[model samples]
Target: MKKISEKIVRLRIVVIVLVFLITIGLGYFIPRLKVNPDVMSYLPKDDAVAMQFEDVGKRFGGNQTVIVGVKSDDIFTEKTLSLIRDITDSLRVTDGIRSVVSLTNIIDIREVDSVLTVSNLIDEYEIPSEPKDLDSIRQYTMSKDLYNGFIVSADSKMTMIAAKIEQEITETIDTNLTGKALMVYYADKYPGKMYEFEQDADTMKIKINKAAVADQIRDKLRTDFPDAELYFGGLSFMVQDIGDIIMHDIMLLGPIAFLFILMALYLGFRNFRGVFLPVLTVLIAIIWTLGLMAILGYEITLVSNVTPIILLAVGSAYTIHVVNRIGMEERNGGNYKENIVAALKYIIIPVFLAAVTTMIGFLSFIYGSYLTMIRDFGIFTAIGVVFSLILSLSFAPAVISYFPPKKRTKTEDKPEKGIIAAMLMFFYRLSVFRGKWVILAWIILAGVMTFGGFKLERRVDLLD
Candidate 1:
């Protein structure tokens, strides 16, 4: 520890420069990280069944069925039946939809004399207009057992359109064209600046965004039938929903956590170095860990999206310990380099121990966990914690040395008498005055919570 501290102070310039360059390099990869909210993709890649499914995805694409439900007072009437037909036709032609099944196209079997015949439940083009014909068709349709409760509600007021998506997804081309000609036409139509395609004929496969495809399908449906009431469900829609949640989590949670951490740091240290330096270490650690994940082709998943917040909340502690120790040792008023070294020599073991214990707790999740999401959360969190510790020891001290810490004033030296202090006083009084009752309350609460924890239901779905 003494040797490492001496070296850190001796080569502080190199340490600072090297950390800055590496941080900048890692920061570049942060924007390239891709979010994959598909829960099935989290399946172990080494498993034979999963590999076979993935190969199918690469070749023929895959299925994620989304159901769109339409409601009406009378579904067999000409107007409602026509609307259903239009919806089926529109969705069938939509780019991302592999197939669509609805009341208009659902299979119907009927006995004609002695022979049985199979045909569409409702005739797409020949919807009945007359009341008698419509009622007759309705009676016949309602009598059949095949369509009940599955394609339509038992009461027949609601009908569901099931579109099995080609999960590879696609852009719905406006024209009936193929190959390079289609591309050329769009390029000419949109002109240079009007539109920009993220992928061409070749790159589309290499860079696929399933959530974008799902959203496109949703937008197309809503545009085609603006008046109709539609309810969306199933895996493809859930994927889109999860993708939205991940975006919010990444954009909002990190900043919120960092703000809270900053507030806490200010309360603790009452100095700029106390807040900024600790947070800086955490930010750098997060960037490096995320950059590593992106460069290695691991996705930002629903589970891993919380990585930034976790680092923000937990990783800053290492730097806080270092900063506090350095502040304490600096009171001796020795040489700057000597004081920094003395502080580091004593604090390194405690900081490393605290970090390693947390790392081990997270590392435990990598084993005996059934879900790959949990395993990934464990792996990256462990990595991030370690990175935080390294930066706290190396980058933090080097930067701290550059800015001489502010002298603690007599007022600042005294403990705060804010809400936290009042709360502490209350707790201290309770512990001293009502110690037995406090112990009894804790015991009862722990028992109840332990019982509740035993009854907790575990669910695997990533998106609600």
Candidate 2:
């Protein structure tokens, strides 16, 4: 520890340049990172249900299903029928679809001119656009005993298309269709998810923002069918939606947390280096963790996405401790090199132990957790903790060696006794006078928490 601290002071320029280069290198990989939002992807491979589901998806098409609902004022109109025909055709050629069943292609057994005939309910290639033809087709579809709740609903309000195989048609909406309603189902097997990502021009990877594909279909529908409302559901769509939400959090929450931390550090330390150094430590740690994840072929999971904010909250403390020790050495009139070396030797061992213990706490999730993402969260967070310590020991002290703060006036060094300081002083005196009672109060609180833990119930949702 002594030798390392001496080198950090002796070669401060080299350390600063190396750290800058590394930070820039890691930052380059941040844009290429991806998010995985599927819940099933989090399940452990040893999970029996997941294994069975994977086998089934391989044998059939896929276990997951997509349901698209379309609503309009009237389902039997010439315009409405044409829209359904278009949607069915679009699904037929889409990747991962196994089959498609709609009014245009479903087989029908009907009495035509006093003789029974089996044929398609409507000509697949020719959808009726004329009013009389639309009316005639609706009547025929509604009159059949099998078509009432199968092809057309009991009431002619909603229409649905089924794709990728002839899936069971059951009573989806029990209520009679008063408003416009359309339903469609398409099931795909594993690895053939319905919302499979579209390739970029340069073949860059992307996450669940299936907007590339879904947007194309949605934009056309909105322009061509202004009167209809479209709704999407199913595993693939859920994953896509979750991906969007996680991206929003990653983009918005991390910066907000950083600003809050900056404000708090400024309030406490009242110096630029005090605030900047700690923030730099945590930020560089986060960048290193995320970049390492990308380089090692690990996609960000919903669980792993929280690492940045967690490291931001937890990792700053290591650097703060180093800065505090250096401040103490500075106030004693030590030179910059002497101050940094003395402070590092005094604080390095304790900070390293603190980081290791905290890392072990996070790593416990890896040894026992059933969710793969939970394990990933543990691994990356532990790595982030180590990175924070390394930065605190190396980058933080090296930077401090060159830019030791000016000795403050007596009043500035001793912060004013504001409301917060008043409260803190009160607590300090109370602790000194009534130390045993304070300890007893803490024990009582711990006992209450233990009792409460006994009454807690677990709620697990593996499917989510």
Candidate 3:
């Protein structure tokens, strides 16, 4: 409560700066970061739904697949047929594959000594070397036993390369390595579906890993064949791809927003101290939030990526409001103490309201069904918002008090009103011209809206 002065203000700023440095340093040094990605981990394991989901993922092949489409003008041509042979051969040796199906994968029909035998043919053939033999290959491909339309086109122009991935691999594969490798390469891909056996409760149906692995292989092939057309589908690959898109957007969008916020703060205050001080506060808050996550063992996910940028954008408003007030008071012949006090008095309610509203907006996410990353986001951002509110109130006051801008006097000639004043005048004129008409228009619009709402019927079964 002592008279606001330069020394008192500077002392306050020193305290804030010290706290920021300590928090940031502690954040960097703390160790612990856990990423529990399994959605089931958050749910009570004993719950029936959770158990059923786990069983489905395990017994039903875990939603992974690799699909290879072999396309050729003449799929039966010996060259393209041989290519299919080579690709199947490559897949069999690949690790973590549970099952593979193709034209060559089914039984091979052979006749010897007037008797016919149906045996696995994929193991019998070397890569067919002659283009002339494509006719015979086509005949063999069409035989009822080798491949139905499921693996080869009816006209023998295309064939499918399908594989089921092991569940254990889906559970434990290195995400960064596989995701990067697959997204970088791949041609037309389709994910396989899951079907359940009619009679067996424990038995599940379908393939896995084919799509994820195929995308990687396809991306690699792009280096040699730039025009390759690849399409990928399947529940597993779609999920992984969605996760990737989210990560990619965050990586690109967050920094750009932060830089824009810094620029806005500079333009609003027109002072180097005004820009740097709040920026430092924002940075410290960010590092502290993230550091706390790391210390508490949280992984950065799609939802948590925007927390820092949001803090920067929303938190800067406090500093901007305070400095604008200080600048206005200085121009009106007030001493530093009077200016700082007046600024604080004007902004305290607005700043507190903004912080509470922002915190509430984020808190709403805590009730969402997806809790793993989104919950973490809610908790972390809430902490940052609170810190932002406190710093905005404390740091701005201290900085203004310590610096104690040069005193103004009534005898001096006042500087001309600036662009802000001009803009306000223009807005005032616009209000005078349009105010009554705007109100009348809004009333009419509201009446229409109300009538429309009354006429509309609610449909509870719309989801069906």
**What ranking of all candidate models by lDDT puts the best one first?**
1, 2, 3
Against the reference, the lDDT scores of all candidates come to 0.82, 0.76, 0.63
Tens digits of per-residue lDDT for model 2, 218-298: 454566656676666555566667778888988999999999999988987778889999999999999999998888878
Better of 1 and 2 by lDDT: 1
Q: Candidate 3: worst 10 consecutive residues by lDDT?
A: 190-199
Q: After the best TM-score superposition of candidate 3, give how far the Cα of residue 454 lies from its true spot, in angstroms.
A: 13
Tell how far residue 228 is off in model 1, in angstroms.
1.8
* Residue 288's lDDT in candidate 1: 93
Q: Tell me the TM-score of model 1.
A: 0.84
Candidates 1 and 3 compared: the better one by TM-score is 1
Per-residue lDDT of model 1, residues 312-349, tens digit only: 98899999999999988887677777889999999999
- Model 2, residue pairs in steric clash: 61-189, 62-188, 62-189, 72-180, 98-164, 99-163, 99-164, 100-163, 160-183
TM-score of each: 0.84, 0.80, 0.67
Please provide the root mean square deviation of candidate 3 (C-alpha atoms, Å): 9.6
Question: How accurate locally is residue 325 in candidate 3, as Cα lDDT from 0 to 100?
Answer: 72
Lowest summed lDDT window (length 10), candidate 2:
181-190
Model 1 clashing residue pairs (backbone): none
Report the error of model 1 at residue 308, Å. Answer: 0.9
